[model samples]
Target: MSRQGRPQDTRKVSGELFSLTYGALVAQLVRDYEKDEEVNQQLDKMGYNIGVRLIEDFFARSQQGRCHDFAQAADVLTKVGFKMFLGVVPTVANWSAKGDEFSLILDQNPLVDFVELPETHQGLLYSNIICGVIRGALEMVQLEVKVWFVQDQLRGSDSTEIRVKFLKKLEDAVPAGED
Candidate 1:
C-alpha cells in the first residue's frame, strides 16, 4: 500500500496520553467487573464499537479501495491500518497452509506501555482490544473473521502476537422495506 496521500498530522492524541487514557480505562474496568474475563469482554466490546467507527476514518484518510484477497488485506492492515492508528507496523507471519489464517507479531504494543498485569488478573488479555478492533474492521469490509491473542508480552511472552482467521464474507443486507 502506498502512503503517498496519507495525512501526516492526523494524530491528535500524543502517544503517552493515549496510552495513559487506555490504561485508566482498563483499570476502571478491572475494578467494575468481578471476573477478568468479563473485563476482557467489555474491552473487546468497546474496541468493536471503536473499530466500527474507526474504519470510516481509515477509509477517508487512507483513500484505499477494496482488498483483492485475504493476503492483501492482511498486508494492508499491518502496513497501513496499524501504522495509521498505533504508529507501529507489526510483522505478519505464521500463515496457515490454506491461507485463511495469519498472525501479527508486535514488538512494541502502545497499549501495554504503562501496563503490568497483576497476579490476580492473569486471565485478562491486556491487548484483546486489538483483536476486537481487527475483527470489527474486517467485518465492516464484508469479511467475517475470528481474531484473538495467542501470545501477549504481559503474559511473559517475548512478543505480542495476534492471530486472525478468516471465516466467510458476509452477504450484503438489504435496506429495511426496500426488498
Candidate 2:
C-alpha cells in the first residue's frame, strides 16, 4: 500500500522551468541557424509567450478565479499570486485616481539573486517578464495596460516598485462599414 500520509508524486514542473529551459532552446536555435539578432528576438518572444500561458494558469488557480474589476485583480495579484509563486507579497504603493495606473511595491525579490545586468542591457532586471505577464493577463479581459519596473531595490534602495499604467480599454473592432 502507498504510504498513508505521504502526498502523491503530484508536484509538476512550474514556470521557473520555462525560464531555465528557454536558454537551451535558444542556444540550439542559434546553433542551427547562426543568427544572433534573430535569436535574441526569439528569446524575447518566448518570454512574452511564457507570460501569456502562465497568466492563464494563474487566473485559474486564484481564489476568485478571474476578476470582474481591475481593483480586485490588483489585490489578488499583489497578495495571493505573488506569495504563492514568488514568495513575496508586494504592497500597493499607489493607486491612481484615474483608475488606469497603479504600482506594486515589492520589498523583497527572490528571483533577482545572482542576477546582474550586462552592460549592454544595464537598464533591465529580467523581472520585467512578470510585468509582461501581468499586462498580458489583464489585457485578455479587455484592459489595455503598460507595466514596467519603476524602481529596483537591488540597485540599492529600501524597496522596489513596479508601476502598471492602464493606457485604455480595448474597444471591440467594429464590423465593416461600422468603423
Candidate 3:
C-alpha cells in the first residue's frame, strides 16, 4: 500500500533479484578494479552512483501523482519510503509550520541491527547511501539540500536521525508552449 491519491508501482521485485543485482554489481567492480585496494574504493563510489539514479526513480515512481505540497511530500517520504526500503515506517514529528525543517525518526533500523562499528570507524554511518540519495534527489528539484544523520538522546545511541536542510527551493518557470 502507498500514500492516498498516489500512483503505485505494484511490480514486485523479490529479495533474490535484489541480491543478484548487487552480486552482479560487485562482480563488475572486482573486474574493473583488478585489485582489492581499488575494489573497496569503488564500492563506496558505486553507492554514490546508486544514490543518484535511485533518487530519480524515487521521485517519479513514488511522488509523481501525490500532492506536491511540502507537508504531504514529507509524509510520503517517511511513510512510503520507509516501509518499502527499510521495512519500518518512521514517525514524523516536530514538523515546522513553515515546512522548512523536519526530523526523520527511525524506530527500527535494518542496517544497524547486529552491526558494530570498528574502532577506526566508530562514527561510521550506515545509511550514507540515503544521504547521497537526498542530495541527488533535491538537486534535481532545484532544491539544494544538505542531509546528515543525527543521534537523538531518546532512542539512545542506536537511534538514527536524517536531518534535511533546504538550501534552496525549485522555482519552475512556465513554458511558452503551455501558454
Candidate 4:
C-alpha cells in the first residue's frame, strides 16, 4: 500500500497508482522521444536513477547486510527486495551452471496492470524499467550486473521473465581530493 511499506503506516496508495503513473510516464516518454528505442533507453535511464536512490532507502529500512555472493544476492532480491517493494515475490529459476546468471519469473507485475501496448509500441518492452532497477541496485552494492526482460506479459507473453547476469564486483575508488 504505502510505497515504502513502513511498519507504522496505515495509509496506502491506491493500487492503480503504480499502473497509472508508469503508463503516464511511458506515454510522455514516447511523445517526447518520438521513437520506441529512445523511449526505452530513457525509461531505463530513469529507472537506474531511481534505483540508485531506492537502494539506499532499502538498505536503511531493511537493515540488510552486504550479500556474500550471487546466490545470496538472488535470494535477497526475490525474497526480500521484491516482496517489500512490489508486494509479490517473483520466482527465481534457470540458474546457470556457474551460478552467475538466473531468471526471475514475475507472475504478477503491478506496473503492467490494466495496460495494453499499442501497435506503435510493438517492439517496446514496457516493463524494461524493472531490469534497469535490478542492475542499478546491484551496482550500488558493488555487484556489477546485467539485467533484461526476456519475456513480457504485456507483449502477450505467458509470463514476465527478467534475466540477470552477474558480471563482476566493482571496487570502491577513493576520490583524489578525499581523505
Best by TM-score: 1
lDDT of 1 by residue, 42-138 (tens): 8888777777778889999999988999999999999999998998999999999999999999998888877888988899998889987887788
For candidate 1, give the lDDT of residue 70. 98
lDDT, model 3, position 82: 59
Task: Find the 10 residues in a row with the least total lDDT in model 1.
Answer: 170-179
Q: Mind giving the per-residue lDDT tens digits that candidate 2 earns over 49-113?
A: 66556665776776456567678878887787777667679888688997767899887765565
As for TM-score, the candidate ahead, 2 or 4, is 4
What lDDT is obtained when candidate 4 is compared to the true structure?
A: 0.84
Comparing 1 and 3 by TM-score, which wins? Answer: 1
In model 2, the clashing pairs are: none
- State how far residue 14 of model 3 sits from its true place (Å): 7.8
Q: In candidate 3, what are the lDDT values of residues 1-179, reduced to their tens digit?
A: 55588666576554556545655555565567565445545554445455555655676656555446666766776776556565678876766677777778777655444344445434334445556555554555456666666763222465677776666665783221210
Q: Against the true structure, whose lDDT is highest?
A: 1
* Off by more than 4 A, model 3: 1-48, 59-63, 96-98, 152-158, 172-179
Q: Write down the lDDT of every candidate, Cα atoms only.
A: 0.87, 0.63, 0.58, 0.84
Q: Rank the candidates by TM-score, best first.
A: 1, 4, 2, 3
RMSD of each: 5.9, 6.6, 8.8, 4.7
